[model samples]
Target: MSKTQKPVDELSAEEAADELAALAAEIARHDRLYHGDDAPEISDADYDALRLRNAAIEVKFPELVREDSPSRVVGAAPSGTFGQVVHAKPMLSLDNVFSDEDVTDFVASVRRFLAFPADRELAFTAEPKIDGLSMSLRYEGGRLVTAATRGDGTTGENVTANIRTIDEIPQTLPADAPDIVEVRGEVYMRRDDFIALNERMAETGRTFANPRNFAAGSLRQKDPEMTRSRPLKFFAYAWGETSAPLAETQFEAVRRLGSWGFRVNDHMAICRSVEEMLARYRAIEAERASLPYDIDGVVYKVDRLDLQERLGFRSRSPRWATAHKFPAEKATTVLNAIEIQVGRTGALTPVARLEPVTVGGVVVTNATLHNEDYIKGIGQNGQPIREGRDIRVGDTVLVQRAGDVIPQILDIVPEKRPADAEPYVFPDKCPACGSHAVREEGEAVRRCTGGLICPAQAVERLRHFVSRNAFDIEGLGEKQIEFFFNNEDPSLRIRSPAEIFTLKARQADSLTKLENIDGFGATSVKKLFAAIDGRREVPVSRFLFALGIRHIGETNAKRIARHYLSFEALRRGASEAEIPQGKGDPGNSAWQELVGINGIGAIVAEAAVEFFAEAHNREALDALLKEVTPVDEEPVGDVSSPVAGKTVVFTGALERMSRDEAKAMAERLGAKVAGSVSKKTDLVVAGPGAGSKLKQATDLGIEVIDEDQWFERVSG
Candidate 1:
């Protein structure tokens, strides 16, 4: 709300998306700094400000919030030193409410769900939200046993040794405590101690961005002595796993936590209404700056544990509780330049190169422009979008990241734009391979036309060849494909799919062995060779899919395989159909026959033909086939029968054959199975409870058969 850019309401969908990406990047950096390193660069207030802005933008753009926003997640990735720990119960994230209206809506939604009367009281426990790492300390038999960071909710890094050094966390709980308990809360450093720690770092020629990062980094040190040397405190505000109930209400649980010799937040209170809840938040905010440790906002939870259970959870966060986050920080910088990165699929992605600026404590260098249209500010209709504003190099742009973790360019200041700045021209050729890059009709992306020659496309195709649905080779994966493809020596490099099968023989006489590679061991190398050899004979459908031909997906490949029955037959047929010279009618040309198969459209047929038309592709196929054989597609039922190669649709409830069994049987008999009934459908097997499909079949005047008749037709 305080930035130089237009209000979230005034921005176009493209502009809003750009802003949201920036916020996400910025927020993620802060999370890593505070939770991962315990060294937050931004103050509690500044960080909170970014979060508040993020919520505002999200409120205006709900669909955009979902892209990269980590609003629900609480902690950063666990440090590498400690071994991992899986929690008995998942430590879920919490939803955030940034305004009083949001708070009011949250309460109202709860009451409406439970059908509670207006007079019914809904008490909530309101407490300061600590700016520190979330830890789950597991205690069994009233003794502190295991301590872990809330790493991605389900699992965390084991920090048991470092946790034992914290004075506030009792070494042992009361004898009357539950037999097993996992106390969940924040581990923070007091203001005085943080200042002292900073002073020590300065004297020792070491530096941390802020107290939060220092606290997080200090707490997760590999050396237990180093952890003990630092002054750290804990506030047990929640619990993860407990053998028995801690209390009936949330308020009572905090008190129970205190009675168990664990340090609990002293500022917690019971707020029976939304007004009371917001008042508590205000009270906390008033004294936030003076607090010994950082408090970004306040968390409010439904007091009654039963109501909390009834509210349950969404996919990721709790329904009965929400954190009231503050706002995010923002800054302005010059747009240095725009760079394009070629993805595996060959689409060039535009990235913003920005002068480094600090947003919520992270040094922001790059922000995603998303696409060429985003950089040029144009819509699909070639109309001016984003109010006709285009980003250019040497222009001053507003960079903002609302606690969303990513930084984005909000807007460019026209007055600050360089007088001689030139418009960015998106390259029409592949930056990597120098091939013609063209975008097809009805598609937004421009891809490099050089699929076979392009190194980027080649690597991706190799990956697809060995993917699970394709070859499914055990040990040969993307890394191996990359390593083998990118080998510096000319003869050793794997240039095509055929080379993968010839690796063992090629390396047999060479001084260097695959087993001698860094990642490969004797057992792995043997397994890799065995896996490659095992795939010598494979299903035709899998082999076709493994070719990595454009637009020929799994279903299309299966349909094509069923149509041709064998690799040689398919290759000859595809090679003969040189161009788009076919009709989608049965008993036509080979191209027409391919197009006639259900789900195999002209586009897919053309792609297959195009692949075969190339002499190099034909050569590659010949070389690969010499080493391996694709088993002819075996008839599912009887390919020579009347119903063979027919497109059959089974609708409604079948009395004899189950839906899956019927489909499988149809495929076994060499029938092309389809889910829906249409003009292309040759036969419709209608059973009882047959609805629209049956009527449509009858209306189309297509042959309609019953379960018994269908079996008879197949058997006869």
Candidate 2:
């Protein structure tokens, strides 16, 4: 169950009904976020819990099932570029029931809905819900005909060519099979395959957020060959359309599908009672972490075909079926201390340092407290809420990692609180610059005082912005960065990276000419302008890195920039994160999406979001963008380039460009660079300091070249 949600039995009918509406709306939003954008904010376990809560509520108040109940929805409507195809039969969704009571209620509801005798014998079958894209395969006359996705249940996208490439999917079924059959199942990438694909993507500076999205994006590629490159497998769990009756029982139909060479999950069984059904669900949940693919829940369906038909469906979900989900990842840990972090913008974010505990396969020693209010259990409206329970130091708190990589304190266990536990007092002063940390009305975060005196934070940022790993401006060395940063003359001082672009404009209004400045000359000034203009169009990844958000380093920044691809798209995602979500969740949806990236944790996501949240930060970025447009992130570099998959070394002074530039270029060509040359070094570019490395390369028979030769070959 969701941490924020009240138990179904505990809620009044009206409250339960309202909760159902909220849950339904929340699930739909998630569907669009995950299905439409391939960016899901919550984890599978978290999402399933929401659906489970919705089901439990509906079970308590069956009549309150909304028209938009998520139970009825199949996979998010396939809103893709592929041409559309309508399923012969709608790909109906199964209702979900989380607990034993919900399962018992489901069986009882089926009997009541069918008007069957209480004593009548009934059987049900359970199967794992593969966490993958749903594809409907249509075969005509024992030959492959068409393949489609479960788009909006009734409509689907045509992927016949792509599906044909999967060796697991048979082009032609057994000769004895029905003339027409639509094999419905999931198209998935195995766990090992997913890990390998991610590793390969990372080596090339590209990556996938998760396996399900990777499979969906891969299978839906415009070019079928692209889909063929992905290692995707399929499992036939159910059928959509058939020319002849396959069997009377659901188990028999699945067996017949297996007999025809269709892969079916081995962990399936017929359950005689709700207890047996619950046992199966527990068993699946236990084995879930080991499964190669993902399954959000275990789906149970009535075994008898006639009975299933009689039970039919209630609006969107079949009354004969319900999915029992696994519990989300949650654990109790000591709240060792609360550490306060002052970001670039001076926002004092409270971070929870906890006793090491594992949640969702990751050791979590740190979690976000979000704000001081969260520790005090203050509601968004400033009223006391969540039973007015404040999270105290030394409290045994519930830490949970939902679809988010960052763990959070769900609630405090008052009973387990330490005797010496004391209320945490949030600092009113900035911890970094010793300035006033003031909170504005209607804002949850506090900001540090800003001025010339406290420009320490901005100064550090300026240094990073011009570092070789960032924008790598040739003329903008540390001395220049510091000089211009504290320029004494207000007209020339740069407060942010964006102001760097406006230097020429700022200089134009000054009485002093840059060329006449003591250390600068006509030639030097021109060279400086050339360097600045040369980078007028900066790479998006470098641009993002130059901003210097907390926890976001070069690698993650590059990943984020490439993922968003454009400055405008990245800004929009940040802006959208502030909008209200389904249940007043501060939305943080875009933040959640950002966190979904493999290495992007909650802390990093929060930093990015906070950086964007500030009006000053946004203004500075906008000003910089007006002067210089950030280039779209480059695609994963040429893996087949000449230097691809080779190790190289640069052991001397580089005259053509900075060593950073050489490394970037070599990496772009898919080459591994090492500090020391050995037998593994395919080539060595030795310059002025050639000394030891030169002799070593000669002795090791490693290819040795000069700067001129190195540049000549790359250009060639």
Which tens-of-lDDT digit does each residue in 1-716 have in candidate 2? Answer: 54776767899988987887778779888888777666565566677777767777888888887877886677677674766789998887666666788888888988788777777878999998787888899999998888898878889887887787799998888987899999999998887777666533431223455677788888877545457668899999888789998899999999999998889999989998878888899888878767777777899999999888787766666778878866677999999999877644566778899999988667999876777786898855687755789988899988876322436787888899889899999999877778898887777877677632456557656776777767877888867877788777765677677777777777889886778778788898788878877778878888888887755666667657755778888878766765444564634546554654434555567778878888877877778888878888754556777776566688788886556457657767766555555555788899897788789889989898888988787766
Over 4 Å off, model 1? 1-97, 100-335, 343-345, 354-367, 395-416, 472-483, 488-491, 515-524, 554-589, 596-598, 631-646, 649-671, 674-716
lDDT for model 2: 0.76
Q: List CA RMSD, all candidates.
A: 17.9, 20.7
Best-performing candidate as measured by lDDT? 1
Candidate 1 shows a clash count of 35
Show the lowest summed lDDT stretch of 10 residues, model 2: 199-208
lDDT of candidates 1 onward, in order? 0.78, 0.76
TM-score of each: 0.50, 0.48
Cα miss at 505, model 2 (Å)?
60
Estimate candidate 1's alpha-carbon lDDT, on a 0 to 1 scale.
0.78
* Candidate 2 TM-score to native: 0.48
> How far out, in Å, is residue 618 in model 1?
1.6
lDDT of 1 by residue, 1-716 (tens): 56677876798988888877888889888877666665555555566667767877888888887545767555666666567799898888777777899899989988988788879988899999887778899999988888888886777888787788788898788987899999999988776777655533431224344455677788766545357668898999989889999999998987999998888989999998888998999888777656777777799999999998898887558888889876545688998988876654576666788999877566899876655675787745576755778888898987765222345676788888889998888889988899998866766566787777899878877887887778898887778888889997544678788898888888887878777779998999899889999999999989998987776756567778876789888888887764543463333256655665555676788889888888888899899999889999865557787788788888887887456457657866778776566676799998999998899889989899999999899888
